[model samples]
Target: MKQGLEPAARFAADLAAVWPEDERSGSLGLAVSGGPDSLALLLLAHAAMPGRIAVASIDHGLRPEAAGEVALVERVSGERGIPFTPITVKVAPGNVQARAREARYAALAQWARAQGLGAVATAHHADDQAETLLMRLNRGSGLAGLAGVRSRSTIEDSETILLRPLLGWRRVELAEVVAAAGITPAYDPSNANADFDRVRIRQALAEADWLDPVQLAASAANLAEGWQALSWYAELDWHEMVMRDPDAHGGLGFTYCANVPRVIAIETLLRIIGELGGHATRGEAARAWERLWAGENASLGGVLAVPSVERVEKVGVAMRVWRFRPEPPRSAGH
Candidate 1:
């Protein structure tokens, strides 16, 4: 078992390193799920931050025991004299896990905003980061996807930050912290369900003596640094080489010089499509990139990319332009 106060001190130090100075006066919202990981976070955060923390538990309503699990967290928060709020969110159909996650974060963001909190903290530890990296790797993800969970991030478009203070701590260490605190956390049965890919990955990692969560999490952090560098260069290229097409009908098109590097061109096109509310998968984007590279017109994600002639210094030159035109809505019973 680990020393209880040591974990609390470590969590505080991590938070102090990243906590924005402008938000020093604001309280933080903690998302606790009554599991060992989140419960350990709640206890540690309370010790470190004291009365400045607001606790919240999101009930996805997918399982019969979810309400009871949330109640357990509420009871613990009450014992610690921390204000607790229980939030219930409805999970929509299609992709249950993804939908549930979106709903949970949406609820948490809304609650944090209402409470006037500056940020919401979650209990994603090093083991979770390792699992995320493996999952993305299995899907042949790019560098950005392989970066796994970030220590701090914005939830969608919200200004309220999402902080993962325990990313440096291992799962067993958290369990030990909970045990040292004399707390019995409610177990979530889904964690052991082999049908979930994450559970299978976690089991495999547990059985593999050669794999270490600390090393995997470190690799993910390194990839995150590389991803940041790529994004920085992409943004610089976008500003220098891209502009609004003056001839486009009502400013619907984006024009870019053809002399930019191939990678920057692809990144600029993707960003333009995203800004225009177009949804394109990685495969679709890759195909579009190839078409553009071949000097052929391409259409994807409700956007069309075509070669254009522009007069520069009284000389007509070839340029690439993307126009945003969404497809018409389908009528019922065609």
Candidate 2:
């Protein structure tokens, strides 16, 4: 029991630290994927804080056996005497996985709000943290992108907080926990698709002798420390200097919010790119930002060119915003 409880104790400590504040009723929501990662979380959470927790699973309905998987989760929850709720999601086309993830969290948030849950916990381990950092690096993300997924946060306009309990644990440790508990863990098939960037990373890591889970977990911890310092500085600047208008220039106005540190600028730009129906990478933010600073950022599609219209006239005094979309794609007949 001590060995089995090792990883669980560490994870539970992380959760309790991030979620120290108690709610009126002291209820917590658990996001279960039916994998060892989350199953372990359920078991550990039970051991760590016995009375205040409940479970919820989001079924993205993409896989053929997804509903069966949900049933398995319910069975496990029932066996453990935990209350469970399953939310089914219909994923949209184009970037299906990302959309599915967003919908899953949104559903969880709604469900938690309804249940009067104070915080929602997930089993995002250290390996996932490293992968996200690498992905953001490959995408030319800036510091905030490099900072990776947060361990604790709240969804916008919601009372429920997100707590990642296993951010310090490795996948190897989790596998051991599952084995010790005599549980069968479900693997997410989407994790192996070669077409996805993250899967490519996983495959590359698998072939390396030095890519042991422990080493990867250590490296991720280092990255997280660096990211924490960078994020602290960024938050200071964001609150003090940046101004944002969601509707400005069809959301390209997020560019004008770049008055403070470059970190806030990039985060705001990330939000803007999503609003503009385009995926903006860190490189993309740098590209757009360079133009904005030099007075040559393209000024089309209700997007503003910061400073002024006339290059010579008090450059920083006049702010110019225009609505310009790149020429529409040609029709099939054309």
Candidate 3:
């Protein structure tokens, strides 16, 4: 029941704030998959930024109709005079959905870099955010994972904006916008594949009557807000005890947490180790870290061995991080 162009206007405002390319002229590229969500984004960006945005349809060529749908996307892009770039991809079962998505983004990101574009926008919306939040929570991810998708980000040294203006709107609202604008988008069949966790989550959402979608969507936003605040605090205290933060060696580096308060130091050290551990999600890492600080330098991350000699140590291998306290070597005469 929202009035005409409300979402479009809001979307434009959000993109403008996120990109702000006037300060730095950019030929932004968008990943338009010929779906309602992406199509609406293309339409709004075309209307808002005029020549500043370009549309690219990644024809995964998974379905028989994919190429033709890509043609429709090309036609739409032609209507706006935004150069359409179609990159065809092979979506194989062996590659998996994640592989396909990763490939799509990699190709698009490379294209953006070549064109000297500063931002690339995708059509990830509120429902996507909700599903992602649930997935990360189900995995018992940390507070950072609860933040859901970011509004904007820099990946691979490219200062590209990831604008998700539609992230607050529902699928129904987006569908209405696309229909009212008279755009029929091709649906990706892969979205229904139950093998993928995201697709399964979507199916689950569609069937769940007890769970309120609107409330869950709001909860995602609230979780994102809370996660950001907590991350700031975690980083603030962690920096104090980070005497020698982890280097490119991909393992925990020595830290001087002695000056920090007992409770604060313990938490701060755990955060440091967690950060250094990268994707390692072992509770044992925390225990190993605590043991190191508690006067028993033990090997952590399976390789760097730390034997307490008072000062903490971090090495290329966890089994070698030893506390360096000089022990006098007996002379040959003695």
Candidate 3 contains a number of clashing pairs equal to 16
Each model's total of backbone clashes: 0, 8, 16
Show where candidate 2 strays beyond 4 Å.
Answer: 1-5, 21-25, 156-159, 212-285, 306-334
Between candidates 1 and 2, which one is better according to TM-score?
A: 1
* TM-score-sorted candidate list, best first: 1, 2, 3
Q: Write the per-residue lDDT of candidate 3 for residues 1-334, one digit (tens) a residue.
A: 2435466577776676666647546777888888898888888777667888888888766678888888999999998789888888776577566668767777787788778876788888878887887788788875556678776665544455556666766777778778988888888777888988888888888788686655666677777777666556556666643555455654346544344333344345455445445222335545655676665754443334343334334422232123211223457988
The residue ranges of model 1 lying beyond 4 angstroms of the native Cα positions read: 1-5, 20-23, 246-248, 258-264, 308-334
Inter-residue clash pairs, candidate 1: none
Model 1: per-residue Cα lDDT over 1-48, one tens digit each: 233547778888878766855566579899999999999999889988
lDDT of each residue in 1-334, candidate 2, tens digit only: 3235565576666676677645335577888888888888887787777777899888888887777778777888888788899889888887887888788888888998888887888888878876776677788765555656677777656657888867777777777877887889788887779999989987776677575544555565566667777667666654643344445345333423245455555555544455555565666666676676565745333233343343223245444332223334568999
- Name model 3 segments beyond 4 Å from true: 1-5, 20-24, 61-65, 89-95, 209-215, 233-239, 245-253, 256-334
Scored by Cα lDDT, where does model 3 land? 0.67
**lDDT order of candidates, top first:** 1, 2, 3
Q: What is the C-alpha lDDT of each candidate?
A: 0.83, 0.68, 0.67
Candidate 1 has an lDDT of 0.83
